[model samples]
Target chain A: MIEHLPALIIAIPLFGAFIAPLFKKKQSIAAVWAILITAITVILSLMLMYQVRLHGIIVYVFGADKPTIVLPSGYKVPIRIMFEIDGIGAFMAISATLMSFVGALYSYSHVKAESGLEKYYALLLLLEVGILGMVLTGDLFNLFVFLEIAGIAGSALVGFRNYRGEASEAGIKYLIVSAVASLMVLFAIGILYGEYGNLNLAYISRQVSLSTLDMIAFGLLFASFAMKCGSVPMHYWVPDAYTEVPAGINPVLLVSTYASLYALFRVSFTLFANVSISLERVGWIMSVLGVLTMFIGVTMALVQKDVKRLMSYHAISQTGYMLLGVGVGLTVLHNSDALAEFGRTAMAGGIFHIINHIIYKSLLLMTAGALFYVTGTRNLNEMGGLARKMPITTLCFIVGAAAISGLPPFNGFASKFLIYESSYRLNPLLAVFAMVTSILTLASFVKVFASAFLGPPLEKFENVREVPRPMIVAMVILALLCILFGLFPDVVLNKIVYPAVDALINVAQYQSWGGLA
Target chain B: MISKLVTGSGYWSPLLWLAFLILFTLIGYVIYSRGNPSYKKESEQVKPYLSGNAEPSKEKIQVRASDIYWGFIEALKEYYKVLQAIHTGDVRDYILWYLGVGTVILFLLVGGA
Candidate 1:
């Protein structure tokens, strides 16, 4: 049973999504059922994490007589579907499942009054399945399948409030963009299949020769995944989609974007690890994109009046720090001295930022949702003096805001500190841009705190109260994690993040699981 | 200790920072406690004073969200103009940017290869 935990994690959510609609009339039961299903998936994902930690990497072949049989009988390479759960995959799985669990909990009270409770919960579960599959699957074609599932479910949920024209419009835009990106992914997969005749990532990582077609495929995969992850100047759809997504499930949707980011890193570090691809050139490109993403995201966020839209732009901006950090690592990939000096730390900073970003970003979005729940609006201009009415939500918002701003005693600062220290060694300008972006991020959140939470209490909100206990619980879970990760950065780095970075840079271990080495 | 993170160039210890923060906070509190006792909340001294002029309504005095960064926006008007213009919020334009970026990446990779 433990050996099959990888398959069970995905299968449980897939099955739960199908049966969720059965409790259509029983909305309360439906909420409980959804929470229970997500909770079970979270537990299974944790079990899988522990297994991977105990046994290095777990390769579960779907059609083989035994789960460990990567090459059956006479076959030279793995032709069957398989899950390759390494350190990073396990790390992302934990993040995705934990986020889905929290989102489910928050949705119980946030959307209970809305109609279509059944489909809403179903789509939420499907979204989780999609994210889990994307992070866990080893086959390239399987990744494409999961990407589509997540894209479709995420798009549907974005447009779930169909009565509002903006919601429907945002949903349609998201669907079209997702379809195009997924098609590009499929095309790239087809290119790889044509060249190597195998869809397994580990197998292909061993077989790739860096041909012209391979370069084209790598380009397509890089651009498409980067776009999916909401990097600028290709990030136009992010604010529109995120601003309109139901605040309850917004964090999960953000996790889906990170899944795409995982794919991007997988393609760069794992798929092309052995090839003599121009590491410096590629790294520079990524660093440039990171700088642009951070600067533009914050500038746009600073001018926004809508609460969620501002955060969405900040989401794009924060992604820049990750890119810059990891890009610095990639730049020094071949130089062991530079890699040891600053490159590994930079990558660690970037990787560590991913988990930290999800925690504080989720807390921030939930607080935004709580504000919307009470005020019936998302416009910051329409809000004032909420600190007096909803003290708990205000405190959560301050934690999230301070964290995202890279203030001390919060998770965001720890990751940004790593990024700043390492990126500065590569180029002073990179670190300077990062620091400027942090300042701008602080300014943007200050705008939100002042305009939305502070000031004299508005007459209309005199009767407003704190959000429900469940929403508070969800936010508190993430808020505490923010502080925990901040205060004890080395524990998380040594236990979780370093293993992931090692898994990415060390291609032999990934290939060994598939008998490719 | 697990609380200390040593980057290649430097180190960060949030626990140490917290300890200093607590110490300073306590010191600040002691100083605050010895300050003027005449200051009181919900008193006439707490009311808004507009340079000895009549005070405006609460709604009028409070700065709105858009007005918070008026000068900053004005300072970067040229930059914002280009940014806002590019972000037309059109799906067609979004696709164009995607294709444009894709073409550049393809060129760079193939050229480098």
Candidate 2:
């Protein structure tokens, strides 16, 4: 089971995705099949986490007994494709699949009356497969392949309802940006492959010299991945796409965004670990990007009237926290003792926020989906007094709002507290900016809550009811996790988050897992 | 029963905070919930006040969502103008921004190298 788990994780979804269209005749069946595929993928991800704990850093090379780092003829590095599952990969995998599964479950009711049901679930599974592959694959070129698959699938999903308002426009925008980004990533890979003569990441890392071209390649990869993750100046497409897509699909898209962020970290920490560039300077550059993203996202969110668009901007803002945490980690990369003192905590804060943000952000979006499900509109002015009609959705939204705002005793505050306190140790201004962003985030959500949910009931929505049970169940699960994780920060900190941070910093363990040493 | 999650550099224990929050919340909820009924619903008491003129319909009287944060938006007008200009909603401009950043990064990083 351990030997075949990697292949199975990707294969189940890849095969199941194609089969999803077959059940088009029965749309309900298609939805069920999607749920099953995603559920199994989630379980497999959990199992991989357990297996990695029992036996550290499980390496499953494709078509070989060993990692195949040493070719029988002569070469001295890994040549075959491989899947490396460590604590970080498992954390992301489980988060992605778990969210994807929940998104599918919610999609059933949300898209039931809409057309293109079959294509919707198919793209859903394929998107998850792409994200899973991107995180789990050990080969650099293979990572690019997964990145393309995700990019394409994500673009199509963004325009699932192409005939509707601005959906097609958003899709085209996303496609063009993705094409440009992918080309940049591809050119970067070409440079690396030309320099090192290897496509495997661990192999390339061992042999890569910090030539001028290599530095250029790293810069290209950084810009492209940062754009893919919706950083500022590169984030204009985010609000358009998030608002246009079927609300059920937004959560899965959020997971994919995290996958791109994971790529950014992996490329910098592992791929360029031994490079000759001033990592601390690079870290400062990334820190500037983080601060800009946080401020711009919240300010733009303040002026938006559409509910989904408003939350979409917040998603970009939340990405800033993760970037900031990791940026601090990189800024202090030189001193191992200092890194252990605060850098690890910063990485842990960033990675932990990835987990927290996914839960609360998706829950908030699904509540927005439920609003659209009944209200038939995404505009905030048109929605009023919903709390009286749909109590469950209201409750879920409150939990999500409180969490996203970093109110104490929720998951957001726990991760953010780590980021705030640790980053203050590095630079007080970064912490100050982060805290201001948090306050602005709260203010923005309050506006949404007041205008959209808590106002006097609109006459048209007199009969509004709670969302379907499956949708509510999905939201309840996320909400429960938010509260639980918040209450027991120490448990999550010790058990899941700190381990992933350790895996990230320990590039040697990753290289040895590839059998490069 | 307060326990601390001391990570050496940072600590975030929700125990004391949670206790304080629950205490204040209960006190607030009790005071707010104790209010007696002083007015009738669907009566003249429920009518909107509009400086002695007849009240407009709810939709007409209600504030636009965008208007809610008008002051903040105005204060950040210069910043927003630059931002909104960059987000021109045109595909060509979007690509330009993407390339423009790519070029900047290429120079910034390669120059350092």
Candidate 3:
């Protein structure tokens, strides 16, 4: 039963996704069922994380041969794709499931009047399947397949409001860029295959030797992953796409991108372990990019009249923090002297920031969605004194804003403090720049709060009321979790987070978990 | 020689850098004090251009969305035209670009041997 847990975690959603399409004639029931499916997935992921915590890494292989017939030394380790869960994978899976669930629940009313509600629900489930698969899978090729699934669903959801020119335009841009990035990844995978002759991540890790070809493949793979992460120079489509997407859909896209980033770390560690390339140089590049992205995104967001566009720019800025953490970790990992201490600190900070970003960013986006629901507009200039009508949403948005701006006593602040503390300890200049960015982020969120929640209540908003009960429930749940994660961060860092970071850092342990080496 | 002088980590380079910094500071100070009058004008001219008769009230001024950003995007209209022409929007063109770049990469990597 425990062995099947890994596959069930993803399979339940994948099956529900396909079955949802058949219920096209009954959109109402299908939407409820879709919500139920995501709920089940969230529960399963919690159980799965608990299971991984008690036990070690969970590995499930396909096509088992009667108690696993002993294989010869030279023979391949059975061609089955793996779904292994450790600390990071579990955290990502839980986050993805929760976001997908909330996004699904909100969609009940948010998308009720749409033409193809059934199809929307189905794609939502499919996207959950893709994200879950991306997080849980222990194979590179499988990761690519799931990436494609998520990408297609994301593009479709972006274009769901097909009548709007902006929607169609954003969808097309996302589709083109996503397709190009995936192709770049596939081409890199092809190179890895020709060289290593295997697609399993652990096996590839053991086999890959640092070489010119390998380095080139690594560079291409990094570029592709960066594109997906919406890293600088490749971030043009994010604001437009996120702005055009329905509020209910924004969380799914945001979480999926972070999930992809988690996959990137796993694959990168596997392929580039002990390579000649300088992880520090990459780290420096990432730090500069993070600095640039944070300032630019916030400044642009400040100028936006549309609430969605502002939130979209905030998404870009949040991606900067993640890059900063990961890059610093990689930089330290590249140097032997700093590998033992600084590397762990940096990597932990990075992983912590990833989790924090997921929480606060989703909260912020959902708050925006809730505002849009009540006021029927995404322009902050058009909204005023909504705090009086939607008190719960106002509280949630302020918490999210405070957290994102890295204020004290919130999940965002805690994680970002670690990042700033570690990065600054590593290099004072980088830390200073990061601090400046954090201050600017605070200034930007203040603008969001003032324009959207404060000031004289617009006349048009006189009749405004709270969002639906279910959505409020979802938002409150997220808000509570954010506070819990903030206050007792040690629980998360020690139990859930460390194991995940350990999973990536300690390749030997990963190898021993499976029969890869 | 200029590149060498700039790149070298020597006293001469430090002197050159200091000279450049001083020059930049002087120019920046001047610019900050009097650089772009348009910015100053925009802030001071928040009241609709009165032309000395107490400009039209806020209720009379209508602002539209299209009036923003498109102007900057339009400033480089020729470049945008070139960009638009190159972007065929066909899936095949995207694929071709991907494969062409892939082939070139492969050649460089394998050719390195």
Candidate 4:
């Protein structure tokens, strides 16, 4: 049973999604069912994390007598679908599942008054399945399948409020963007398949030759994943999609974006690790995009009147830090001295930021949701003195706001410190841009805090009260995590983040798990 | 002993920062406690001095979100013009950006290859 944790993580959510509609008439039961399933998935994901930490990577092959079998019956190639659970994958799974579980609990009260609770729960569970599958799968085609599943479910959830024209419009735009991006991914996979006659990522990594076609496939995969992850110049869908989603769905959607990011990193460090392509140039590209994303995202966030839209822009800005860190790592991949000097630290910062961002950003978005639930509005200009009514949310918002701004004693600061120190060694300008962005992020959130939560109590909101207990519980869970990760950054880095960085850097080990020498 | 996160070039210890914060906070409290013992809450002396004008409603007094960074936006009006123009909120324009960026990246890769 312990060995089957990988399959159980995916199967539980997928099965839960299928049976979610059975309690259509019983929305309360449906909510509990969704939460229960997600909690189970979260436990299983943590178990998988422990297993991977104790042992090494766990590669589970589908349709095989033993979970360890990658290639069957003396075959040179692995044809069966498989899940390659490395440290990074397990880390992401834990983050994604935990976020989903909180999302489920938050949604229990958030969407209670709304209709179609059954479909909402179903789509939510499916979204988890998609994210989990994408992070865990060893096969490229399986990744595509899960990406579409996430994309479709995400689009539906974004437009879940069909009464709102903006929601429908955002949903359509997200759907189109997701479809085009997925198609590019499929085309790239096809190119790889044509070149090496395999779809398994580990197999392709072992057999890749740096031909012109391989480079094209690499380009497609890179751009598509980058676009999916909301990198700038191609990030127009982010604000629209992120703002329109049901408040409870925002974190899960964000996790899906990180799944795309995970795919991007997997491609760069593992699939194309040995390819003769110019990694420095690719790294420069990512770094440039990172700087641009950080600057533009914060600036746009500065002027937004809508609370969720403001937070959405900040989300994009934060992604830039990750890109910059990992891009620096990629730049120095072949040089062992440089990699040891700062490259690994840079990568570790980026990977650590992924989980940290998920926690704090999700908390911030949920606070926004809580505000909307009570005030019946998302516009910051229309909100004031919310702290008087919603003390828990106010505290959570402060923690989230400070963390996102990279303030000390918070997780964001620790990660950004790593990125800034390492990137400064590479080039001072990169760190300058990062620090400036952090300052602007602080300024933007200060505006939000003052406009929405501070000032004298308003007459119109005299009756406004705190959100439901479940919502408070959800937000508190994330807030505690933010403080915990902040106060004890070393514990998180040593226990969780370093192993992921090590797993990512060890391309030989990744390939070996796939039966490659 | 609190663990320090050593990042090749430098290190950070949250415990040390916390200790410094606690020390400064205590110092601030001691200084604060030395002043304003006679001050009273909910008194006429504590009310806002509006230059002999009547105080307005709380909502009217509060600054709106749009007004938070008026000077910053005004100073960067030219930059914001181009930025806002690019964000036309049209799905067609977004797709165009996607294609445009994707094409550029593709050219770079294939050309370099």
Candidate 5:
């Protein structure tokens, strides 16, 4: 039963997406189906994670052929498009599902106010299907296919409220950029095939011999994924697109970015594990970009009048931290023989931050959504003293704020602490820059909290009331999870983080899986 | 060997050239700013005389955000147009275009392989 959890996770939402359109005129029925689908997917993802932890790696083939092939070196590779689960994939899947679940829960009341509820729910489900498939797929081309699905779905969802010119414009911009990025990725994949004729990740990993072609392919692929992940220079589209999307859709968009960034690591490390890919270059590029991204993103966030845009910039900044962790790991991988251990530390930190980002960022987006639900605006300057009228919303928003700012005993701090500690051990300068960025982030969120929630009551919001129970329930669950993950970092580390780390560092494991030595 | 070295060095040359170009721009801007009396006199600054009486407003004379990078974005506007042109409100056109692109990519992959 557990063995088929991977397929089930993807299938439920997919089936729901198809079924949702049939209930086009029946909004209530569609909502119930979407909820049921998301709930089942979340439970399945949890169970899958448990199974993967109990076992080593849950490697399931789509269409199995020979059991395993013995190479000249007697290493056996499984012959199929594998849906291999390690800690990272499991954790990402769970976080994505959980957020989707919460987002759906919050949407019942929030989405009731909007028109085209059918298309909205259907696109959301399709977006989930793409995300799940991207996380689970082991083939590079399959990953690209899933990437396209996710990108198109995201753009459609972003432009869901197409009446607004800004939404349409932002969605168009996102679409163009996404298309170019995908093309570049496809070109890189072409180069890889030319160099080593394989599309399966394991095969590529086995056959990858360092060359100019390999390096160029790495650069192109990395750059494309970096753009998709909203890293420094290529991040201009994120804030506009995220902010312009209908309020309920913000969390969905954030999760899409989260999933894509994880895809970057998953694909990159799997393919380029052993090549002399210049970790120093990769590190400097990522860390420098990360520092600038964090600084610029947070600074821009500070002066933003619109709460959604502010949170959007902060999303860009959070990507910076994750990049910094990965960069530190890459840097250490080259300079020292303790590469695997230290790299794991950095990767673990990065993965932890990714999970933490999903929780807090969604909560914050939901905060924005909740505000929009009542006040009909996302501008923080227009909001004030909502702490009295919308106490639960304000509390949830504060928890989100605290987590994002990386304050003590919050999920953000735990993951960020690991990133900082690991980077400090590798290179203290990056560590320093990371610290500064963290402080700036804290400052920006503080400004948001102060301006939006803490000031004297605005006359406009005088009659504003709290959102319904379901939305509150969603926020409360996320807030509690934030604290839970923060307090029990070791539990998360032991079950999820460590196994992912082990999988990443173990080249032999990859080689064995790919039938290459 | 010569081609490899040339290609390798070619990458850095542009970066170096860019550095110099930026430095020159900075120096020019500084000298211009220093020499021009209008730079210091914010109150006296008027919209550049464009053969007509410039309208007065409280806003400072600065390029709007959209206008600042209009050229770069305008260059890419064609792709956006192409995308928007495909918005025929028909799902069939989108599928056809996707099929076309996908076929090209697949051909490239197989042929390149």
Candidate 6:
């Protein structure tokens, strides 16, 4: 039973998604089913994370003679699909599952009033399956498959309120871009498959000769995944999609964005693990892109009036921090001692930021949703003195805003501190710009807090009240996490981040899982 | 100490930071309390006033969120022009930008390699 846990993790939510429509008329019942299934998925993911923590990497081969069937002595390649659940994959899976679980809970209140909830829950589960599969699958094509599933489900869910032309418009844009990006990924995979006859990541990594075509394939894969992750210059669709989606789904969708970022890291660090691809040069390109993403995203965020759109832009900016950290890690890979010192710290900073960003960004988005719930307005100009009316939501927003701005004693500060301190050693400019971005982030959120929550009370909102109980509970879970993760950085860093970093930078660990040893 | 992270370059211990924050805040409060330490909550005194003049009604005095950053926006007008021009929100423009970024990445990674 334990041996089958990997496949079961993906299967359970999938089966639940398929069975969801059976309770279509009973939205409440379907909601309960969704929550129950997602809770089980979360438990399974935690167990998997724990097991991976105890043991280094647990490889599960599918449809083989026994689950861990070693290939025959003559056949060196692995033909069957497999799951390589290392610390990094498990960490990301745990994040994806936790966010999805909270999302499912929040959806009970957020989507109950809306129609077609059965489809909503189904799409939500499928979305999780996609992200989890991308992070967990050992095969490259399987990543592409999951990428498409997530894109389709995300697009459909984005337009869940099709009657609103805004949502439908955003959904269509998402679908078009998602399809184009997915095709590019498929094309890149095709190039690699043509060169090397296998689609398994470990197999390709072991045998990657890095021909001219292979380099082009590498470029294609990076571009596609970067686009999917909402990197700058390619990030216009982010504001539109994030603003139009249901609030509860935004946090989970945010996970999908990070999944793409995870894909970016995996392709660079794992798929092209050998010397042929020139890690330093590729890493520099990513770092430059990261700087551009950071500056452009924050500058644009500074002037936005719609509260949700502003947060989305900030989300793009935060992604820049991760890119910078990991990019530096990639840049310094040629130096073993440096990789051990600054590079590992940079990578840890990037990965730790992923956890921190999920906690605070989702809470911020939910708070924005709570404001929109009671006021029916996403415009900040229309808001005034909400702090008095919705004290809980306002408090959550303050915590979220402070954390996101990298204030002291919050999760963002701890993660950003790591990135800034380590990346500075690599290049002082990287650290300076990161700190500058942090200040701008604070300014941006202060503008939000002042306009939306502070100032004189509005007569129109005199009778307005706090958000629903479920939504508040959903937010407080994250808010408390913001405090805990902020105040206890050492715990997460030692226990979670280091192991995940090990899973990433140590190519030998991944290769050993491929039966190379 | 609990909740502390140490790297090669520096260390962050929230316990110590929190302790200092509490200490400083207490001293500041005590010092400030030596002056006007207490206030009465009177609705009439809480109304907005500007330069010893009666302020406009709250509705009339409402500041548009967009207006909050006018000074910053004015100083960076040219920079914002480029940003806004690039972010035209049109499909063709964004697609072209995507292709352009991909092209640059291809040259940098592949060409250099």
DockQ metric for all predictions: 0.84, 0.55, 0.03, 0.79, 0.02, 0.69
| Model 1 lDDT at residue A176 | 94
lDDT at A286, model 1: 89
Q: Which model is ahead, 3 or 5, in terms of TM-score? A: 3
Off by over 4 Å in 5: A65-80, A334-342, A514-517, B1-113
- A-chain TM-score in candidate 6? 0.98
Clashing pairs in 1: none
Clashes per model (N, Cα, C within 3 A): 0, 2, 1, 0, 0, 2
Better of 3 and 5 by DockQ: 3
- Name the 10 consecutive residues with the lowest summed lDDT in model 2 chain A: A66-75
Cα lDDT of all candidates, in order? 0.91, 0.85, 0.73, 0.92, 0.72, 0.88
Q: Show model 6 residue runs off by greater than 4 Å.
A: A70-74, A514-517, B32-34, B49-55
Candidate 2 vs candidate 6: which has greater lDDT? Answer: 6
Top-scoring candidate (DockQ): 1
Per-residue error at A7 for model 6, in Å?
A: 0.9
Task: Give the interface RMSD of candidate 1.
Answer: 0.9
Q: Tens-digit lDDT track for model 6 on A361-447?
A: 999999988888988999999988889999999999999999999998889999899999889888899888899999999999999
TM-score against native, each model: 0.98, 0.96, 0.81, 0.98, 0.79, 0.97
Comparison by DockQ, 2 against 6, better one: 6
lDDT of 6 at A60: 84
What is the fnat of model 3 with respect to the true interface contacts?
A: 0.02
Put down candidate 2 lDDT per residue, A1-517, tens digits, no spaces.
6668888999999998999999878999999999999999989998887786777677777876554333434656667788887788888888889899989989888889887788999999999999999999888888989998998999999989977859988988888888888898999999988877888776677666667898899899999999999988888888888888887888889989899999998887888877635577777777788888998999889888899999999999999999999989987877788798888888888899999999999999999989999999999989887888888888889999999999988999988888897888789999999999999999998898888887666778888888889988988998998898888888887777877787788888887773434
Output the number of the lDDT-best candidate: 4
In terms of TM-score, which candidate is stronger, 4 or 5? 4
User: Which pairs in model 4 have colliding backbones?
Assistant: none
Flag the better candidate by TM-score, 1 or 2.
1
Candidate 2 segments exceeding 4 Å error: A66-75, A514-517, B1-4, B30-44, B50-55
| Residue range A1-517, candidate 5, lDDT tens digits | 6667777788889888888888878897777777888899888998988887776566666754422222223434433566666666787788778877887888888878667888888888888888878887767787888888889988988887888888787788778777877887788789887876667777778787656676666666776777788776567778778887766566667878877787777655667776644555556666676776776677556556677887888999899888888777666665555455465577677878888888898889888888878888887656667788999999999889988988766788778877776777777887787788788777677766766677556667789999988889988988998877776676777777767766665655664553322
TM-score of B chain for each model? 0.88, 0.74, 0.39, 0.91, 0.35, 0.77
What residue pairs clash in candidate 6, if any at all? A410-A486, A411-A486
